[model samples]
Target: MSRDWTSTLVRARSAQDGGDLALAARLLADAGGDPTAPDDALRLLSGVLRAQGRHAEALPLLETLTRRRPTSAVAEHNLAAALGDCGRAGDSEQAAERALTKGGAAPETWLVLGRARTSQGKLAQAEDAFRQALAQRPDFLPAYRDLAQLLWMQDGDLTRMTQAVAPLAALAGVREDAALLYATILRDTAGDGAALQSLAAWVERGSVEAALAAAAAASGLDPRLALQHAQRAQAQAPHDQRARLAVLTALIAAGRAELATAGLEDHLRRDPGDQHARALLLTAWRLVDDPRALTTEDYARLVRTYRLAEDDAADRGAWLARTAAALRRLHPFRSHPFQQSIQHGAQSMIDPRAAGDPDIDRLFEALRAPIDAYIADVRPGGLAPTAGGWSMSGAWSVKLKAGGLHTDHVHPRAWVSSAAYIETPPTVEAGGHEGWLRFGAARIGAAFALPAQHWVRPEPGTLVLFPSYLWHGTEPFSGSGERLTVAFDLQPA
Candidate 1:
């Protein structure tokens, strides 16, 4: 352990350069325990630990490095980032501020500060930090992406989202997700043809991310063009599942689902819990009236509603009021967030399960019985639902204002999906059908464009559960105070 630290660090760096993180970690661990170990060894070891998601193991080393190099901006910045990763957002903010105070004006340092602020729910400060970072380094694509994401979530203004990152659409090395976001915003504002054309310049330059973006934009515009870009992207990055998904989407769009059917089915066979693949395969089969697809669309068998049971001793009214208040505080945004169906509303990004509210915590406790009953009792299709196990995958609360509605869509990645009402506006309480949930329609233009076959009215403290493939939406209400609800998706555990 007390061997020459310098030589060990050199070998570790070489290992790290050769992409042998395990070897580098081993070499550094041998010396990292010694107080006489060089700063280089501890730093490299911390990096390896972080890369491997061993954040707890890395934190102590990072703390030690920060203490030893108190005046070093890079040391402070690294600790800030590591602290953010370890969920100490307040500590991260302090460390990042210290780094900046130490004359570290690097764009990376600003980005770290932005991320720390974001972790603490300081969206405005995070947005400012990202803007400052971008101003310092205009070619910093990460800044563009972070800023765009923050603005989009804040206002849901597609125009602002475009203005935030469109300047960098011509730059190299933008995040793949950022490219897709830009394309999606364009598609929303200017239509699929314009969206596809927007990325053509970059796609023509052999950028895989751009090609993938163009593929998404061209999904409904030109099937052949979408397939071409997606195939090109897949060829460049054979292991990227996103590219493969693009190819599959294009195949379905091109009416050549036959070519993609075997692989999708084989993948589902190997991993039967892959509901996303199942959804795609179902879509493909529905194109040709495959019996397998028809069975899954049995709305009556798959969709059901549950009324939360309340005992005489339970203070149901007060509990719902508290839960609604908790949810209301979370919806600070001006409009709905990205890639969601909620329109003319604001949705909560915080996961209610971990929001640390007593009433919200009890909401899950209330749902457990109904969810269990639904899973065990409901017979989906002609048989039963298939899954290895079941658990909630993600959850969010939506607060829809007047004229708010949800467009028809399916949850491809979920085996089960749900919406639980916390509060309903006066319109719904009046026995009116406005703002009612409608099911059994694929709004996506296709051969099987079915009108909504069933409708469910929302009531306070009631939950509706349905198969993920069931297309559902909400009708816009005329005069409404607000409609508040929480929804979650379930997948095989």
Candidate 2:
């Protein structure tokens, strides 16, 4: 089938420019043209795939592009980035080195190299690469952020991260983010006092971000002061989620959940897809015994568990043992990452496509039936969204040490969420429901706390699925060994 390669490329570019990426990808993929000569089409197709979070699908196209333009530094850099995105850190590192060799030490190349090094658990090497990037481009904001995050993850050394990024924070374009980061870091690491002191000047001068930070730091310490700060932030950014959420949290903490219910309901009425707001509203209504909370939550009907490998000839215990061993090798960090509920455990990189894990692929395939059933169950249940289908948002494995447990939290940005247990501690069965998954407990204290309505015993080769808005966490258990699991989220497409 003879085809015009140039004309196809032009049409593909038009679709891509007009935001019809699926059309662009289809045109490029189906075009019966010379794949090697039309390297531009390959590049464009790869970009389209990656933009849709199909990193694995893009890799071959990028590899072909690099092969076609052997000496092109940009091609090598793109391949390096794609490799990293696909969770092939070692190959990404090699490609980044090739990019640096050909491009003469471009800062972006150095930044990618640093990320690859970090992924490989080479913290010292990663730091050196990040320093090299900063040395080359003094005003690169990403370099500062990555280096600071690396420092924080490596050691909880707040001073080191602050000192490292201070100069770059002074740059005109970087100050706003740096200020916000500084506030959050202070509140997380030090306490409310440090955050309040640091944000005082900015808050007084009408910085909505600073006021929100002030609200967060003071929430539990001084409820009235926190509410005031949140109100100030809300006044500035009337429609911002951060401000709205801050004000709501403060209002609830001050024993004014009834007052916050109207606002939360209004937000949900306007955007029912806001799982975070929905979760908060549930908490507020439950606190005041609004009756709607229990009906809306519907834990009995909505939350379900499945025992995996039931149909397979292999024993479930053996399957779980095999899967657990394979998953442990993917986890690289010794400590949990920031902004996650994982307290003292190591978690695998998000959405890892560990090229050859057949057990993983099989397990995921088995999950499709249950997920499809749930989608069908929800569609006719009065909230039939305009969005038709659901797709996986992210996937990660968690290996919780003896004392580790995820604090109660909701997947605010997702529609559905899940966890599949590969390993469980003996403590789970010995006594109590330790190491068990509990649902419906709001992550708060005193009168504001909503006790868990349901609990699921952790079993090897089993999974639990529920709405992402449900407040959930695991009970911490101590003894020996680790509790290993894979978790993922889903969103409407």
Candidate 3:
């Protein structure tokens, strides 16, 4: 009996190390058929499930184990992680605190607490938690990467971001994320040349993670090399979604949309529930100029709702004027950061309180009806292309002053993208078709001409929705007044 139990444990460990998660889970779950054993097979199974992003499924198991061993810090830590994944941030924070007090000191415990704090918008607390993780394990690459990412995302400060990750770059067993962050920051702040050089140097190391990062970075700087690296990553990790998506995205960027279309179709055949792939396919079809991609029916569903106000011109003008003033006061950027390099003028960062204003909140509420209608009309069969059903993913407002314009771009992570005009300058309405939203433009660096197939004039209170993959931007206009609009991206719920 002792030998049998040992055999099961060894086999389970071997399977997990070999990346056979299903086999490892089965072996662990069946170990002695008793979760109360010292080995704790149930906890192991829950960990495996959580790693696979099955947090909801793993929660009950974690909860059961935590109840059985209430003082076990390991159980509490895992529970906190699962709760965080489920968006129960408050509960996760409490559990994390309990784990820290009960469990022996562990860097991962601190990391989880940091993540919980970050989710709650407690930036300073999160930073301190991550620092505690680093203090516990100096060479903890994940903690360094997280710290760097948080710093960068907060203020877009390259110096502070670099300082956060500099120690880990030269550390042994360094992960790909650190290198990727460094390279991305260089590309954004310095130039593509510097970024590509950094990526190439890492690729020379020949690690799979390095190849994956290089593939992503090369997509913009060198598409041919990106495709090669992506193919290598795919071959190295056949089951990895990162490699597969890189291949698909590289194909599209390289102007091989036909290949991208075929690749996505094959991928969907294998994993039909891959929302990201489904979303990419929409872009692929559009890139290939497939008529079925965004049809007249799709356009009909685009502007489904307009904000209701008194029909009187004075009332509408007053509202637009007030909103524009509010937006100007909230503009967050002087020049667009590299992440949003397409903007020729000031563009705001993702505001944590964007929809908090009563007016803004009401606008979002008003827009929901059309969003639901659009989703219903598009997914008539009730089959969502992605994993989640349908929901708004992110939203931010942009205020473009005179000479301000948006360069053509696609929202890769969004299933649907939208723009709701709040204010438009007189120059936009008076003529040269300036400051109008145009769609169907080819993605940058594509080896083909794809001009704007359609455009819509901005009107206060009117909202426009389109597939996220479609390339769109606003024409530059010469005007002293600012053009204010709120934009958002949506994913499956």
Candidate 4:
């Protein structure tokens, strides 16, 4: 390269490193037409633009760069990412596939392809791609994390997911991501105790100590330890939001609601737009029944998003009747092992605290009535019932046998949602009968408390309601029989 070009490149690189993305783009543009001039420069500029969330601008530049250098895997990958960010999953997958083809299926290429496929909801295909990436390059940390997530989504054993990522945990630049993934795996598999232990260790020893500590506390793990780590992290990096959130979360989780409320108010005073802090604050106030401090708008939004309805009865009942009748006709419900799996998935065989005595069908019917009534009460004219109070709609049922469990997750689109228990085993394992409902902290602007709040020890006859966006899940059953439940969602209508 010419001295002038080299000099211009250095200045552009400097500007990018300095975070002056616009300046870097302008400088790169001025470097002007060597045959390579600007394509190389534009590629770098594209990356900077992407980092700045200007994905539209980045896509064309990266696409042109990849077209010019058809074998450039990095260019292709960046283009695919830009496209995916813009919601063009099909285009992203095509670009990712081309990159993988040209690059001979390297792990990075496969990683991109897997991500693209995942965005398109080709989960099985995505899992295969991720597994293939790992098979080709076992040390590829990204693939491990990606595959673990896919497995988790499939509701595979949490321990297996953790084991999958364990090998990559020590890899450079992967420690934090791996730790977070591992923490999630532990949370789902071993319950809060294990998750709390892992989170505490990460807070004490990891590079993302503050974030880990905050996340741990938010998840209802060792608040004192998390708070200690948060204090240390803040002492070292006073301006870090991660540290502040961690401290705030620890306070919340520890049930120090008053302090958490005060601390959040002070923090928000300094940073008015802190949405996370605000959300925590709302949750804290709600917990304490301090209605005056709550954000009416946020609560309204949450209710409007996750409430369920009674009119849903006809549709849900019809589907249930059809499914049950079909199962009865198919005789799968009579088969020992397949029936076992269904019963296990439905959690019908276990009895948790406050376990209500209701037949699965009866409970479902009862639950539907209230939901339908609520929908009629709130739904605007001309809309339909969706899964989670969104415009979309869906419903499903399951039968869980002994030892069955559901992992944590949120209903993405539905406004109102619920699960109605139908069957409970006559007996349960010691400590197994505590099947309880849990909800995560609302994502809002202020800090309320730490340990993203959870409600435990739910009764079987009792129906609990909350926002759709709130992350929630079920506890494992230790009973010897089957547990049955029908879970449903309602869209915006």
Q: For every model shown, what is its TM-score relative to the native structure?
A: 0.72, 0.83, 0.64, 0.55
* Positional deviation of residue 197's Cα in model 4 after best superposition, in angstroms: 3.3
Deviation (Å) of 12 in candidate 3: 18
What lDDT does model 4 reach? 0.56
lDDT of 2: 0.79
| Candidate No. with top TM-score | 2
Each candidate's number of clashing pairs is 0, 0, 7, 66
Candidate 1 per-residue lDDT over residues 6-90, each given as its tens digit: 7888888999899999999988885556888878788889999899667768988988998998898899998888877665667
Error of 4 at 428 (Å): 30
Cα lDDT for residue 122, candidate 3: 77
By summed lDDT, which 10 consecutive residues of candidate 3 come out lowest? 347-356
Estimate the TM-score for candidate 3: 0.64
lDDT of 1: 0.76
Better of 1 and 2 by TM-score: 2
Rank all candidate structures by their TM-score, best first, as comma-separated numbers: 2, 1, 3, 4
Q: Write the per-residue lDDT of candidate 3 for residues 223-332, one digit (tens) a residue.
A: 78888998888888888878888888788877788988887888889876555566567667887778758665665554344454545888667766676666665553
lDDT of each: 0.76, 0.79, 0.70, 0.56
Count clashing residue pairs in model 1: 0
Displacement of the residue 255 alpha carbon in candidate 2, Å: 1.9
Where does candidate 3 stray beyond 4 Å?
Answer: 1-129, 153-155, 172-177, 184-191, 231-261, 271-305, 308-361, 376-414, 421-436, 444-449, 473-493
